[model samples]
Target: MRVNADFTKRVAVHFDRNDWIASPAAGVERKMLDRIGEEVARATTIVRFAPGSAFAAHTHDGGEEYLVLDGVFQDETGDFPAGSYVRNPPTSSHTPSAKEGATILVKLHQFDPEDRTEIRRSITGDSNLQLFKDSREDVRVLNLSPGEKLDLDAVDGLELFVIAGSVQESDEEFSVWDWLRLPPGARSTALAGAEGARIWIKSGHLSQMI
Candidate 1:
């Protein structure tokens, strides 16, 4: 199955308008953002785990990257609370679970085959956090004050997810959990809404995939 699989077009998804679909694991559901295959697909998704639920042990042959949206995410490595960002490179193995329920925005099977970097971080407070950066992509979190303006120069490609609050791009408003993807060479700007906004952005990655 595919959802927003085009790499050359700009697309947006509003959280409130999407429905959650259950995964093979009980009590685990997902909101698929982009996909390119079936069960073992290269995909971007928001996954939610109900309390006491766990996923079977698995190996990340292609890699796994995620940011905890709420609650705590657990694995053999450690317990990650909200605001935590993690990357499990290719060949890593883990059994993920949530004791008190949790939600996460995750990307799968998108790493360079030779890449082996591992990162774990937590975004605390209002400061902007630079999650990761390399030749292929730049990933970060930005916190905006009410009425602030943000300029985006996505020369390679762009993907932005609203983590909290709202921001407007042209006439369109992106609120919490809203997602946007832009093709290579796109340049744009967004203005924060009355309550400001917190956004997670990744750029320069899509070009490598396409």
Candidate 2:
């Protein structure tokens, strides 16, 4: 029940290449990425809900983070449309359903017990992105053109996923749904392809023990 459970090694996968498997819920399918348990597992997956689909009420023991990739994702708490980022902290409960269908990237049980920050970001056009540069670190998330590179700090690691368009790192070409995890101190660079790129990039978690 473990996939990429080791913290020392890097794990990368192209979710688009994986087979879609049905979940227990009707009309809901998933592309499981990394999992570490049974039904209520610590997992990361891409879930697609057919129109009128619903999932029974459930509780997340650790936490849940999700980004709406397309359509609308809804729960008792609120409705999250495409481009929405959400985090339900540990010990949360909800019943999720979709009226017009939807797809989402979901991560479960990957939270730091003390890190209770919840975030919701809607990254549509006209959003003003703030950038900061220091001697040792530079962090930014905005419209990135081809050949633009981000240099993550040496103390932490970089995790990059191509949310839209394509990106090339070394000789590896990653399209939508492709994820790359770089180990601590790993030096890597990426370039957006012809269509340019919009990505969700996160760093500063390399020291976390899995």
Residue-wise C-alpha lDDT for candidate 1, range 145-172, written one tens digit per residue: 9999998887899999999899998589
lDDT of 2 at 135: 37
Off by over 4 Å in 2: 126-141, 152-154
lDDT of the candidates, in the order given: 0.92, 0.74
Over 4 Å off in model 1, which ranges? none
Of candidate 2, the 10-residue stretch with the lowest lDDT total is 130-139
* Model 1 clash tally, residue pairs: 0
Candidate maximizing TM-score: 1
The weakest ten consecutive residues by lDDT in model 1 span 201-210
Give RMSD (Å) of candidate 1 vs. truth. Answer: 1.0
Q: What are the per-model C-alpha RMSD values against the true structure?
A: 1.0, 3.7
Question: Residue-wise lDDT of candidate 2 within 53-88, one digit each (tens)?
Answer: 999998877888787999999998788999888878
